[model samples]
Target: SWELLQKKVFQNKSCLSELYDVSLEVAKRCKGLPLVVILVAGIIKKKMEESWWHEVKDAIYSYLGESEEYSRGTVHLSYDNLPDYLKPCLLYMGMFPEDHNISASNLINLWIAEGFVQDVESGRLEEAAEGYLMDLISSNVIMVSKGGRYNGKVKYSQVHDIVLHFCLERSREEKFMLAVKGNYSNFRLSDWKESRVSFSFSDGLSEIASKTRKPFHQHLRSLRMTLIKGEVSNWSAFRQFSKLRLLKVLNLSSHRVGRLSSAALQALIHLKYLAVSARKFNFHPESHLPHIETLIVLCPFSRTVLPPIFWKMKTLRHVEINDVVFDLKNNKKWISEESSKLENLRILKQVAIKIGADDNVDVLLRRCPNLQELEIGILCDEDSVEICQLESLTQLQILRLSIDSFQLNVSKLRLPLHIKKLVLRGTRIESIVSSIGGLPSLEYLQLVLPTFIQLKEWCLGDVTFHKLKLLKLECLNISRWDASEESFPLLERLVIKKGHELEEIPLSFADIQTLKQIKLVQCKNKSLKASALKIKEEAEAIGGSDIIDLIVKDKGFEDAKKIITALKGKGISATEAAGFCWG
Candidate 1:
C-alpha cells in the first residue's frame, strides 16, 4: 500500500547535505517498512524551512531514542510534519466518527468549503482539491476501500486507526477543533476559546445548550454533529449560532431534525458546505444564503420538501437528496432574467422525485450543462420525461434513470454518448435493454427489473457494449440471455442477482479474457450453476484459473447444492453449500 511513496522517498534527493542527513536519519528509523518510511517522507517533503526541518529532526531523534517501545508517537510525528495546506484537511477527517468510510467527493467538497483548496494553474479549485487528496493517498495517509466501477476512481476512503489517533491528538494540540462526546453538561464553551471548529457527538443538540446562552467562540467556522439523539424542541440555539459569520461547514446528519427556522439559515451567508438529515425542512421565502456551494439532504426513509428558497441559490456546486420535488413552475418569480443559471453545478442526485414535467426538470438540466453526474427519478404516470433532453448535457458522464410508470413511453429515449455509467431501475418497458447497448462510452451498466413487469428475454448482439467493464442485472425474468463473444469484450465483472428465471450462463463469457469475477446471487437456475462450474474447470485446465473468480449464493436451492458437489467431485474448487439467506 505504501510502496509508491517508498520509491519516491528513496530516489528523491535533497540539495543540502544537512537536509539529506536529517532525511537519512528519519529513513533509518523507519526500518525499511513502507508505511513508516512513507509517513516520514510525507512530512519531510514539505519541510522547506530550515528551522522546521531542524525541529523535525530533533523530534525524530527523540522518537528514535524510544524506538524499541511501541508507541503511537511515531505516526503522530507524521501529522506534526504535514504541510500547512494538508494539515486542516487531514484533521477535518478526524471530525467524523471513528472507523467511518468517508466519501471522497464529500471530503473534497468540505476541503473546498473550508478554503483548504485553492485554484492552481492547471485546473479549477475542486480539481486542485482532488490532487491534494491524491497526494494524501500516495503518502499512505488514507486508503481507498471502494473504487468506482465506471470512472475507475476512488469512491470511499478510510483513515487507519493510528493515523486517526494522530489526527485527534494534533488537532487538540493545535486547537484546530474541539470534540464533545456524550452529554452536554460535560461540554463547556470556555474550554474551546482557541478553537474555531467543533464536533459534537452529543445525544441530542436540544439537550446541549440554550440558544440565548452566550457562545464560547464567535468566530467558529465549522460545526459537525454526529449520532444525534432524541427530538429537537426549540431551534433558538441554532439561531444563536447564526451570528457566526465565519462558519462555513455545518453537518447535522446524525440527528433527526424535523424542522428548521428560516431565521436560522438567513444569517449563515458564509456557509459553503451543509448536510442535514430530516423528514422535512421548512425555509423562509426571504431567506438568502449566497455562499452555500455544497448541500446534502439525506432523508433516507422519508421525503424532504425542498422549499422554494433553493431556486435562488445559484452558487450551489453540488446537491444530493434522498427525496425532493423541485417545482420550478410554481416559483416562476425565482427564474428572472437576472437569475444566474446553475452552470457551476457538477453533481446532482435526487433519489425520489415527486414532481416531474410540471417541475420543468428538463429546463433545469439545460441550465446545468456542465453537470458531470446526474441521478433522478420519474414517479408520475402521465409525465413525459424527455430523456433526449439530456443529450444537451455534453459533459455528463454518469446517469441513473429510474421510472415507476405503468404507462410511460421511453421508446424514443436516446442516451447521451458521453455517459460512462448508467443505472435503470423499476422500468416497466421491455425494450429498455435493446436501447442501452448502443451507448458508445458506457463502461458500467445496472438494470433493475420491476416485479410483475412483462420483460423476459435479454439479447446482446455482437459488437455491443464494446467498452463495458461491469454489468449488473437484478430482479429480472430473462430466461434467455443471448450473446456472442463480440459482445462485452472488455467486460470485467458480471453480477446477476435475484434472477429466478435465468436458465443458463452465456457460453460466450468464457471467451472474454478480461472477465475476472462472476457473481450470482439468489439465482436458482441449476444449469447456470453448472455452467459456472464448467467455466471454472475449463479455465483451470488451461492454467487460466488465476484470471477468474466465480462467486455464487444458492439461496437454499437443492439442485444448486448438487451442482456444487459435482464440481467438487471433479476436483474443482467449490463452496456452494454455504448459502446466503436473503431473508
Candidate 2:
C-alpha cells in the first residue's frame, strides 16, 4: 500500500522525512486497514501543503466517527473522486456477482464495445483501458487476482464487497448499468427505463421478458444474460430486442439462445458486437449483419464452417470462432471481392480453413494488410505455396499456424518482417533454427510437432534469434540441441517438454546474460539435470547471482526436492548417471 502511494505522492524523500510525524499520524488513522490507508493516501497524494495533510488527518478521524456505515464512507469517497471516464468503468465492474474474478481481456473488450474506452496518444484503446485497470489496482480500488505468465500483465482482477456496494449505489443513481441477481420473477424494469446497460445473473428469461415493456427496450444499448446454473431457458422473448433501435452489444449463453429468431437478429443493423453459439443461430447467405465490428461464435459441433456472408462484412474489426472453414476453390472471385472490403480488420482467430490446389491464402491476407494478430489452420495433404503468401501481411505481429495432415518444409516457411510471436503445431518441420534466425522482432515461439521425425540436430548458428525471449519445444523427436550464447542473445525462458529422444542441454546457455529460468518437463535424459546444475553454477560464478531456477518434473517435484535435500544433508554430492530411480 505504501509503495503504491510512494510512486504517486512521496517521490521526494527529503520532504517525506520532514513530515514524518504527519505521515505517522496518518498511518495511525488507518487502524491497520491497508485498503483505507491506500485509498486515503491516494486521495491526498497530490496535496503537498502541510495544512492539507492536517485537514486529511482530521477528515479521516471524523469519517471513522461512531458508526460502521460512516467507516465505509472513505471507500465511497475514493470511488467518487475517480475520473469521469473511469467512473463508469469501475461501476460496471460491480455488475458481476460479488467475489467474482473478472477476466481483464474480456472486461476490456466489453468496455471498448460499450464506447467506454478511448484511444490515447500512447497506445490502442484496449491498451489505454488496461492502463486504467492498472491505475485502479494501484489506487487500491481493485485487487489483481492473477498475472499473465509471459508479459506480467494482470489477467484477472477482483473488487471487495465494500467497494462493490459503493459502485452499485453510484451506478444506480446514474442509471449507467443495472445488475439483477435474485429471482427473475420479482425483478422489475419499470424504474430502469433510462438505464443504458442491463445484466442478469440468474435464470428465467421469460419472466424478465414479460416485464420488459415497449419504450423501456428503446433505451438499452447493451444486454448480457449469464446463467449461473447453466440451465436451458426459452429465448423466444428476445424478439423484443428487434425494436431495440439503440442496441449495440448482445452477449448471451448458448443455452438461452435456443429459440432466438433469425429475422429479429438480422434487424439489428446498429449492432457492433455479437457473441453467440453457432449451433443455436441459423446462418444463411442473405442474412447480413453489416454493422458488426466484433463477431464471436462458439461452435459446439464438429463441422467448422461459416456463412459466406460473413466474409463480406466491410466494417469488421475482429472475428473469432471456435472453428471455421472456407470454400475458396469455387468461390475465388466472390471471396476475393468480399475479402477486399475488410480493410479495418485487426484480429482473426481460430479460422480452420481448408485450402485447395489452386487456392491462394494471399487473397485473404493481402486484402487485410492492417491485421495485427491471426490464427489459421490449413488442412491439406501437402504443403501449399500459399503458406509463403503471409509475407504480404507486413503489419502482422502474432501468427499461429496449425498445419494438419502433412509435412511443411520448415525452410520454406516465410513470415512477415514484423511478426513478434509464432506458434507451429502439427507441422512436420525438419529444422527451425535457420528459418527463424533472421526474425528481428520475434519474442515468443512454440513448436508442437508430435509426428515430427526428420529433425535430429538443431544447430542454432551465430548471432541468431537476436530478440527472442521465450522458446517452447513440445512433443518433438529431436535428439540434440546445439546452441551458444550468440544463438539467443536475449532469451529469458526456455521450456523443453516430452523430448523423449533428447539427451543433453547446451552448456553455453549459462553465457546468456538474460536467461532466468529453464524447465524440463517429462524429459528423462540423465545428463539434462546435470547440465542444468552446471549452468546454475557457472551463472552464479560469473554474475554473483544464483537466481536461476531449474524446474524438472517427471512424476513430482516435491518428492524429488525431499530426496535431494536428504542427500545434501548427508554430505553426499550426487550426480546423475544412467536413469533416475528412487526406492
Worst 10 residues of 2 by lDDT: 574-583
Query: Cα lDDT for residue 204, model 2?
Result: 60
How high is each candidate's TM-score?
0.83, 0.86
True-structure Cα RMSD, model 1: 5.5
Encode model 1's per-residue lDDT on 423-449: one tens digit a residue: 888765445555667778889988887
Error at 235, model 1, angstroms = 8.8
**lDDT tens per residue, model 2, 396-455:** 889998977654554566778888888888865545455676788989888887454545
